[model samples]
Target: MSFNPFSLAGRRILVTGASSGIGRQIAISCADMGAAVVITGRDPTRLDDTLGQLVGDGHTAVPADLLETGAIDRVVAASGALNGVVLAAGIAKMVPFRMISQAHLDTVLGLNVHVPLLLIKSLLAKRSLQQGASIVFVGAVASEVGPVATAVYSASKAALLGAARTLALEVAKHKMRANVLSPGYVRTPLLDALGNTGAKIDALLDITPLGMGEPVDVAHAAVFLLSDASRWVTRSLFIADGGLTTRMSV
Candidate 1:
């Protein structure tokens, strides 16, 4: 068989946070690329909405809270042996340093960092993954570039980037690639919530040079990383920010 590269026809992918936002887009895109996708989220209704838009066969919805570490095994088992996994399940909260509480910190870090680690631990069981399985963690540009009122959120995401780099090296021998996709402001429900106030929206747009990107922009980059196209790529961070990280504005 001539190696049919870029064809995920026989691949099985698991996408978390697929109820909405960038996760939803990734699930739909994966299915469109011919992969059987298992999407997980806490909201059954939104998950169903995402599943309704998939383009391939064998797409399933497994609703579960990613923060529940003990349930990861069951979730992975339910998804079957997977060819790819997208850790897009995360949370972000804006709070000043003085206003930050342990509970708040734990909530964000638990989902953004701890849950992803646990999920990978469950997926890395012997014979649990295909030979070329790829893993993508949906980190934020804030991982490298900090923003105001994002101390806790940024710290959690930064840990994800750090973990991805180290884990990539450890998993390289298994032919399993791991990388972080750091996106700038994307047109997602999360952004909508954050930018709801006019002043905040303007402040963000002014700094984003190219303005906010659409979810599809991030999804396209993810597809490349998850496919054989990035077979030799590992232990790296791909920033999809619209020059937001390059600016010298202080």
Candidate 2:
């Protein structure tokens, strides 16, 4: 047996949202660990950039929008068989509950929740996922602890935790595992887009014991969940917060 259980050699993994941010980092880390990664994103140029950052060969870039129903099957067909799948794509809207419109709700839930669920189902049905494959879904700390202006976003993320738990039970028979990676306010483009700047952002960091986190922080956790090191770990949530959740008041 190899001494390094974290090595992903001989494994083929699929990573969604790999054009940038946490997803991009996950793809890079997977390749560094010796996995042949298939990365997907809506941007062909950014996907090519991620592909360029990978350390090894056999890394493929599939440019597709995961929000489209038609894209799900296409992603499955392009990925073929895989030892791991990481659902790192998500959307968030931080607005007061009363102001949230139907379109807003749909956009948030559609990309964050519905797309991953359907994509997972498509991959499983197509046998695109090999037995004993690891599945990691990116969740948010807001799911467990509520934050102002994120009611719908919180709901969408919480839904993933519930689904992942049930999925773990259903897929255990096939030696496959399902888990969630919940990250706190990381310095990603998504955060910036959500208006997590100025004093509001400073306030968040003030409460966090370990301060701000980088994309690599989450990528390290994703690698653990994907590697054989976590073969016994499943149906669980691995939180990579910088102590923000711990310092939250009730």
Candidate 3:
């Protein structure tokens, strides 16, 4: 058989937030690429649904809220040693800067920032992460464009870029790589739930060049990064917003 650089055969991966949206798609994609995936989400029923959709066996599902004490340890234990991990577990709240409350701030930041960092730390201390492991953090274009009413959500995602880049360098000695995947307005239930109707929801003056994308679109980029195809790539932002960033950056 010809060696496929993109193949994830025999690899083990852990995907957080696998209950729905992009995270669930990543887990499914990993399995389709031949990876043994460990999926976790706060919702047990939805997580089980995601596990059932996986293409292969050796997949495990563990439901736990990241905010609870010892939650990271439990998740790390369930994942075992992993070749790749996707930190897609996050929550977004669209509150205006003046309207932001301490409660909302903590909730969003705790999930989006605190949990991912703590989870990575646990994976390291427990040695659950294999050498050359790829760590992908699910970020957002909101960080770049600063969408209105997304003060906290934007800040939370913005934190991942700096952290993931530094993490890439710190883990380089072990051949480990870290990168952030930023997606624009993806048409998921979460997307529909956010803003409902407003330009602020999209943060784009003009229509998105290719319009909104599907979960599989981001999953394809994530699969490439998780596989050996992105071995030479690290500390980069992989934007899968259908040219939204390209136009905005220019």
Candidate ordering by lDDT (highest first): 3, 2, 1
* Per-residue lDDT of 156 in model 3: 96
**Best lDDT goes to which candidate?**
3
lDDT tens digits, residues 88-189, model 3?
Answer: 999876788999999998899999999999999989999888999999999999898887788999999999999999999999999999999999888777
Residue pairs in clash, model 3: none
Residue 233 local lDDT, model 1: 86
TM-score-better candidate, 1 vs 2: 2
What is residue 92's positional error in candidate 2, in angstroms? 1.4
Q: Give the TM-score comparing model 3 with the true structure, all chains together.
A: 0.96
Answer with 1 or 3, whichever has the higher TM-score.
3
Q: What TM-score would candidate 2 get against the native?
A: 0.96
Report the lDDT tens digits of candidate 2 across residue range 1-250: 6489999999999999999999999999999999999999999999999999999889889999988768888888889789999999888778888899999899999999999999899888888888899999999998977777889999999999999999999889999999999999898898887764332666777888999899999999999999989999999989889988877854
Question: Can you write out model 1's per-residue Cα lDDT over 1-250, one digit (the tens) per residue?
Answer: 6875666788999999999999999999898888999999989999999999999689999989877655686688788888999999988777878899999988998889888888888788646677778999999987677777788988988888789888888888879999999998888888876655332656766788788898898988888889988898887889887878878345
lDDT of 3 at 200: 59
Q: If the candidates were sorted by their TM-score against the true structure, best first, what order would they fall in?
A: 3, 2, 1
Model 1 RMSD in angstroms = 2.1
lDDT of 3 at 139: 98
Q: Looking at candidate 2, what is the lDDT of residue 88? A: 93
